[model samples]
Target: MTTTIIPNLQNFYNQSQQKQDNHFCDCTLQWRRGQLLVKPSGQVKQPYLPSLHNQPLLVECLKHSPVNLVSIDPKLGESSLRFWADACEQAHKPIFLRIPPGNKLPKQSSQSLRWLQRLIDWMIALVLLLIISPVMLILVMLIQSDSPESLFSCEWHVGQRGKLFRAIKFCTTKKYKLTPLGSWMCKYGVDNLPQLFNVLRGEMGLLGSRCWTLEDAVQLSLKEQRQLNNLPGITASWEVETQPKLLHLDSSTL
Candidate 1:
């Protein structure tokens, strides 16, 4: 029955209210000891919990949780919500006890446009791949002429919904050394050209949140991870474009 709360919850809640004009809402859970209580905020008293037989209530509860956008910690298994409840309790935030209406949720920016954009991106990628394949082959030969080994490199990346997929690119380095070519490719983003295949396959999009490796994703703050709820991974974003400036500033500050 130990309650651990996140001290930042109040600040986040207050900020949300100011930015959203009090439109920010979530399901409220109130529990003490072994008793579990659930309800939606801003609603009249109703028995939404203990009604596990009601599929709608369950869905509503999930839909309304403020932390829905945050990726669940795998180690928590199904008890993640319980942990959130404990955190809320420790923070001394008023425990809400009714599930919000399921239908009153905001739409994601990428889902509706995905299918239409997929075909267009695929056609563009196919054209690029055809044009680039020969050049890529030549580059591979050039690199191998210097040193013989694997021609391509694959790195696991995090995509939308926190899915992991392999991102492939031409090897720009020797076996042991990440070559100058690799660094150049990364600097100009030439290394990302092969990711067209991922876009064509619907594993990613032409424009959306930039994908990261699992380690990078895990390092992100809760607020940062919430951005992933909208779309699959992409080749670039504001974060990538401004990374250099950000790094410089961070270094100076440090």
Candidate 2:
């Protein structure tokens, strides 16, 4: 089967092949039509599953195959972005997608306007914190009363221009564990209230693309990484548009 390999990843394939390390780049890429492309580094141990016979081969391949990760070709269309994103989340694998050349970039606001917006974000976050202090205190008390553990969670996220920052949230999940109160906090995003401090500290904004975790961000193509040129935000279009579909997919998988 003919698999078009992107030139940039050719070296990675070569290195993986030389090292014979399945741990490094062992994956099957779904190329044009129903063909499967194994990373040249090493052969994928799983038998080939043809997509022409069974659609959703990407997800199925990952679900059943022994391969540790998978990559999707960008030509699969915009909908594939949503599809693969959900698929990768389910597989808990690193995702890689090539953004087509000359893709229109998000317009960067002028420096002065950016400063003004930052000023506004700081002000709003401060006011929100003040207004919600009592509610936040109550949530904290409820959380402590329910779980009796650390009150916050700090995760590293990639911010504007690839700066790493610790994003703070209520410790709603404790490494495969969650309490009833923690689940409620997560469901309503009350767990995220601590991020107001991130905004106040100029590490985040009121609205923009949700900052991708460092693990995910580094895997993105340079063009896709352009989305990070702007500050990370509390919420973004992905929530309203992309996330509900993912939730549905997640539910269907269960």
Best-performing candidate as measured by TM-score:
2
Clashes of 2: 0
Pairs in steric clash, model 2: none
- Writing each residue's lDDT as its tens digit, candidate 2 over 1-254 gives 44543223322333233333222232345444432333322443322323312336656656665545444443433343345555555555544443333334545666678788899999999999999999999988987877676888786565665455678887754444666676566556677788899998887899877677655665677678778666778875235423443344345445
Q: What are the per-residue Cα lDDT tens digits for candidate 1 across 148-230?
A: 67767776555555544567766655655556565555566665677788877776777777766544555566666665454
What is model 2's C-alpha RMSD?
A: 12.4
Determine which window of 10 residues in candidate 2 has minimal summed lDDT: 46-55
TM-score of each: 0.50, 0.53
lDDT of 2 at 120: 92
Candidate 1: minimum summed lDDT over ten consecutive residues — where? Answer: 94-103
